[model samples]
Target: MTPLLDLPSNREEAWRWADLGGIAAAAALAPVAAPEAEFLDLPGAKLLFVDGVLDATRSDLGPVTLGAVDPGEHPLGRRASQGWTLRLATDAVAEPVQVVHVATGAENHLAAAIALADDAAAQVIETYVGAGWSNRLARITLGKAARLMRSVRLLQAAGFTSLREEATLGEGASLVTTVLGAGDAGTRIDGAICLAGEGGYAEFGGALLTRDAQRQECAVRVRHAAPNGQSHQLWRAVAADRSVASLAAAVEVARDAQKTDGEQSLRGLLLQRTATVNLKPELEIFADDVKCAHGATVGELDARALFYMQSRGIPKARAQALLTRAFVADAMERIGDETVRAAFVADADAWLERALQSPSRSREGLGEGSR
Candidate 1:
């Protein structure tokens, strides 16, 4: 495979903003090889990627035929970075494919690929451990009538430089993806989803939390190519300290396409002084008689609501945590699972507790007016 580090570095191009080339700064640092997966527990056929290599002993799903795992070898090369893919065999409903990525080293780079066969049904979960010290990339593809409900848990890896995912949905296929990004340093998720088949539908939901200097940026673009296709995106975020989070999403409906129903909402919560957030929702439509809408909001804790809680003797920190969770839980409900969704909410609640109980408020500007 050819090694191409010629990937673009500027954010001027829509595709290059906050790219992973920054990882080049420390790429040569001795990367600790990922240790043996001793006690990890997962519920599906697992494909494990560690230290940029596929673990044979710990990985249950065998390697894909005629495929490359390194991003540097792809046709796009470093320009678009690299991603993994798996083709689910036609009408094959293999076991749930769980992508478990555990990170323990530094200066690491890796990616994973999966494709669900036509009429396949499976669940996928991505768990990232170790400090966010590596740049991880993944790509997921779905075929006709293929259903993959997936969740990505961004463990408290503060050393990671970037995390990006690219996904495509085929004709009459469906994908529901949830992103749980609570802790990480300078993490950016970029996804481009295409609906190429009629009667196809896609849903994208995500929750992001950032504190201190940690930054999380996610951008998703969904294109509706066939008529009667639908897409909806709901994203919520919380930022504190000097942390920053931004989301820009757009859904496009091609000209002459009708019977399309789609909308996007990107909302954020600023929990402390000096926290920053950017939200941009876009909808591009060239066809009339199609339904599409978009909205975004960035604000601090609701003062009136917080005061209401404090009036009931709840400490300020506890009250803020409650409201923040409640605000994010509203979208958490859209995930459509009682057991898993509840567990996810519980995790978010725990994260919010840690976020609130910590030194979230930047001391430098807590005493003065600030955004």
Candidate 2:
């Protein structure tokens, strides 16, 4: 068993904004059996995991193999006793696959690996739910000219949930990822994208919503190791009722990575004075010929915009919801599948409605000076 001290803390630069105490508490508790809960109503082939172990009775794995794979060097990943491995045949095109993880134990760990052969293409959707401390690790490898699209949803966890994914792209490979986080717990997502081959491309879009003292954080690092590689990161976060949302994004360019194009945009919205949003964007470029840029902004809802909408006969709560929805649309648009995108957007909308309806002392001065 891993020691409690092995877990990351605020002293670490990468975990400076994380909930270390919550993580420690969850890790110290004893593991329990999976609880009873209804699975999400998602379409296509699916794999269900209960308490970090695959539940074959409730899963339809389709073509994805069920076995162990390499769990990287992460401290939590090393403790994973079970995992799944997925591989695509060369030049093959496959349908979408869904992977759902439910954590009801005091401590749960899972690992996953996805590899695409040359010229192969595929899409995957991952969902996380249930309570307790759930830690996950995933490693992805794309062969030459391979393409992969992935979407992740972190929803309705009542305890600490952490996920870390590392992806490496080969020559001419392409990867697109979209993430949505709206959990009622402390959630953390760490992503590392490495463009290891020339002409590789990677794009990431994420939307996060936190309310009622919940916390959500996403940290991503994109490394351009070869020439002509391009990567982009765009993220939006919304916090309400003393909740906190944060994003830490970084881009790195190797000395030999000429003509590398890297861009990052991080934006946050605070629904109340007590709510907090943190954004950090960093660029480390060793190549003088590369083009890398990053931007971050954190602010409250536009008072002028709300006043205008109110003057036009829209109620204050309704107007706020509409504005927040629009703010999250950019990240939703990154999803290529219309059906998946719509479902994620609907989840965000529902969360917003619930947050606005709940009475909270933090929202006391909502429109005080906004005449």
Candidate 3:
């Protein structure tokens, strides 16, 4: 029998607040057969992966090619049994592409690569569903003057999910990423972006919602390797019922990367006293001409706002749900596709309903901390 892969320990900065024990337990289970495919109602071309393998019957790959990815030596890469790659030609504009991963087994690993030529533009959507452990690695590259918009949704009902994304932008290139994660089990996301050419731009916005002892962590790093690069990070997390949610974001500017503009904003809301939310924002700038700023805040819902709503005849639970939805609206707006955005919002609303219906338990003080 093959030995299990050693997962990251809590000592690691990225995994410090992750549920490593739960991840390990899920990783130990053997891979099972792929479950029947139940596709989502998403527009544009679609590629469906069932249990880490491509489902040809259900996938309309268009320009995407299968068996083209070269998974490296990373732990997730080693476990990946299948991969896919997509490339856009110069000046080409294609309809949105959606990739869905459905995990029915105990362990599943997958890899994907996306690239755009000069002046090309495209939108991509990635969705994860079903149970078990799903580990995915994605690499994205943008040529000079290219543009790409990417969105990720983690909608798994159970089991752990891990995703790592690495994106590089060229001169005058642009990349925007929006993520909505509402999985019942634990989730870990590691993202890195590099502005390799002058005038490159990258933006990331994410909203994470956890409840019922669930946990989620996201760590992202943006590096300015060239002059006149710009980047921004925005994240909102909501935790309830003893759950924990965390976001650690960092920005680094090289010594010669002058005129770099970077900003980070992180906010967390706790619904119950036992719940925890952690936000850490860091910046290391060696360029004197750069303008960089970071801010983080963690607290419970505003009692004043709740009271005001209740005073106006709104039920307490309904008022709480309304406030929570409004809190994450900014991040959710980052999705460029209106239809996709609406679908995401509907999912979030459902999660909020379920979360608010649960009885609240009171602890001593607010379980909120930020750095």
Candidate 4:
């Protein structure tokens, strides 16, 4: 049988390290009714979508306008057949807007388009919950001098999930993104941000935690299309048990993008012998005057530090959790909003607690047991 969508495979460089074949097979099954899940308690203008369908009764709409958006020619548009659209029409929105995508069934599609008017400023949060096969897409466009902060959280129980995001920044605009991903089964996310106008700036930070047999990947491409553009990307991942995590970040500077400044850094921590972590950082600069830097590193926890803490009367599990939490806290701190940052930090702490319950005992190398 022909699949509804032509999913990419290892042949494609973008998906070379991900297990897209398994995800595609799982997505072929019919969707079952989704189970009930608790929603995040946040005070703001919020919108909720259940199984790709909007739930108007539970939503609080204010100055922001909500409508239906056609995915059009987007690569994953077809998959988001029933996603929602959001627009920031006002010059400045004091209260943040939150969007929640909940799935209680299989084969669900989610998509959204966000547009910011000129000189506008807004904060947006996206929360994904429940378990199922999902293909999600988000498109963002920023007008001149606009400022936007986007935060995405994926706390799915267990299922196959894929998300793709594209953003374009106008002159002097600023865009910041913070992501917290925890998927039980498998998850993959790809994003691209283009500095289409001069003096545009972009900053992206992400933290992910995977346990058991979860397979996760995050890939991003940042393009400097105009002169004096700037971009920075930082990603950290923690993989335990037999899980796998991969991070790929690329920055491209065009010939006309002189004086461009771009930097990318990816760091991963392996928690077990059976776990795997892959980090690939690439930089292509066509302009000689541009400044760019990219680097990736993967290693196990510092055993000496862990031993020092343990010798200081800390339990083994507690010591491990403390060290692991510090590893990923830098990304969480990058979130600008005080409330949002607190929420994400709390979630990370909870994940660390759960991981410490079944701490990794393998100490094959990487200075483990050297003390």
Candidate 5:
């Protein structure tokens, strides 16, 4: 039997800004049946999990090794035993792999571990949905010279969700992660990546849209423990209707990690008077020969640009949507996969449409403070 760990509360520094109390309350709700899988047609293999149980018939996994068993870690890893297991071997998968998590009115706990063999390369897409609380943990390891690209999309409409990911990179290995999130009552994501071997590289970026009292937060930490490691992180958030969005990141370069290069940027857009956003980007460098930079900004739309568009005969609603889409595209355009990028942008467009429904705020008297 799997045992639950002592869940961390808001008192912890890592979870200080999260809505842990609301998440716990939602998790205690009565359990309901799992929802049917909502398919996304793509040129890739599929792995389906409903309510923490893997569905073999719907899963068309390829050469990758997959099963459900003990992850051999702690309480969170133990959840993998109750959910799905995926491992990559020698071959480079031609198509991306899709993993879907669907839930209903219950607390769903899921875990996934991806281990890449030497010289292997693969693409993976993960999607989460439904109206139930979820706790998901993923741990990954990259062998020498391996490459992995992962994309995540969260459209949980309403519920409490927490996602935690930890990864270690090997010599010359590379890992890229892109995320798109929206439509959740409360969401928290924590990510940690370690450049454990020399010449490793990691890139992390995401775009989020929140509205109508939703609370969304993402915190990521990247550590360089070896020489010649490199990493870059970029994130954008748009909030409206009393919603709150936050992005926090910490980059650390060890004393021995000479020649490390790291960069981080975070930006937020406020579409309503009551909307709020918080951004924190930090860099800790003990190495003398390293280049690291970090910055953050929060503001509203450009009134001048909006007025020019309006003067050009573009409808106010359409102009707002177009500008909002372009704001998020700054980060979304970094995605390598065209299909995944387009899908994420489409979701962002949907969000912008909803955001435009709110009454437009006047720029008068507010000055620079209006934003």
Candidate 6:
């Protein structure tokens, strides 16, 4: 029998590029003590899952289906994660769902899933708290004709590591996944995005900031299974001190999947000479009537821009933050929803300012950290 650790924890692919197993050990469960709830400031339906169990009392709700669940072993009685049988088929106008995965005190693996009704629309805010606890694995899914806009933010105290994120979108479905990472802890996130729909679209974006000996890694895959599907991915990282990071994005457009449009880019800014970053952009196309391209760039911050900002009344710290925000602002700005764009950009800008002031920035390297 295969050991549990080798069970495709769904995090291995991203880890393949970076050594994320920190010297610290992992806890078996998250704390049961009441944790201060940092309600996501956005307006939406919220759910709070402490550790691996749903905390009804702590949760902000929209009706509750209280029960125990396991991804490897489903409580609803499923042998494996698969099929349209698991998701809905009717079009749905989805309100945002904010999920707070908190490790109050104990530690355990956390897993969650979502099956959208066909033609449904949803926005999800996924956050992980790294406050002196061990937490691993958070998985989600979207059904046919469903639309999802998601963001995963990690703000843990130093010393955390290991994250497994998996998502699958069916026919005529669309998904946008974004991540913002920070802290002195060591952590890694593995992402898998599958496009099973024809004429569907998927956009994946993320940024990471690290300091000290902290380490973070991200691996993403977008597969075009049906004809005329579209996908684009952008990932960036900023490291300081003796920090290290790795990111790779793989896009596969299957044969017969005609007119597929895909593009991916990974770029970063190194703040210090000790920072280390690795970026790999890939495209696998078996279709003849498709357009696909990928590339990676690593370099230092623009000195001229920095100098220009300093020449003005702007302080160096704030100026650096502005540049960092500009690095990823275009991506966020392009989002069509005015409300979503405004709120998300505000949060992103705050993160960029924090990254610039962290003092762990690398002066020489490639990649910019996201706010």
lDDT of 3 by residue, 231-305 (tens): 999999999988999999999999989999999999998887678899999999998999999999987878777
Ranking by lDDT: 3, 2, 5, 4, 1, 6
What's the candidate order when arranged by decreasing TM-score? 2, 3, 4, 5, 1, 6
Give the alpha carbon lDDT tens digit for every residue of 280-331 in model 4.
9999899999889887888877888988998999977778788888989887
* lDDT per residue as tens, model 5, 1-371: 11243566667777778876657665665666555555566876888877666778988876445555444554333454545445667655447888888767667787777888878888888888776777788778898888999888887766777777788999999999988886565778888899999999998879778887888999899999999999999999888778899899899999999999999999998887688898999999999999999989998878788788889999777877788888888787767888888788887887777767655443321112345
Residue-level lDDT tens digits of model 6 in 185-216: 55666666777767778898777777667777
Clashing pairs in 3: none
Kindly give the stretch of ten consecutive residues in candidate 4 with the minimal lDDT sum: 362-371
Question: Could you tell me every candidate's TM-score relative to the true structure?
Answer: 0.83, 0.93, 0.93, 0.92, 0.91, 0.81
lDDT of 4: 0.78
Which regions of candidate 6 are displaced past 4 Å? 1-14, 23-35, 63-89, 132-141, 334-371
- Model-by-model lDDT, in order? 0.68, 0.83, 0.84, 0.78, 0.79, 0.64
| lDDT tens readout by residue for model 1, 116-187 | 778887666666655435666667677888888877777645455456566677778888888888755456
Segments of candidate 1 deviating more than 4 angstroms: 1-42, 62-86, 336-339, 359-371
What tens digits encode model 2's per-residue C-alpha lDDT throughout 6-81?
Answer: 7776778898898766666656655555555443455557888887777889888877877776776776667764
State the weakest 10-residue window (summed lDDT) of model 2.
362-371
Give lDDT for model 3: 0.84
Residue pairs with backbone overlap in model 4: 34-104
Candidate 3: regions farther than 4 A off? 1-3, 28-43, 361-371
RMSD of each: 4.2, 2.5, 2.9, 2.6, 3.3, 5.2
**Over 4 Å off in model 5, which ranges?**
1-6, 30-36, 64-80, 359-370
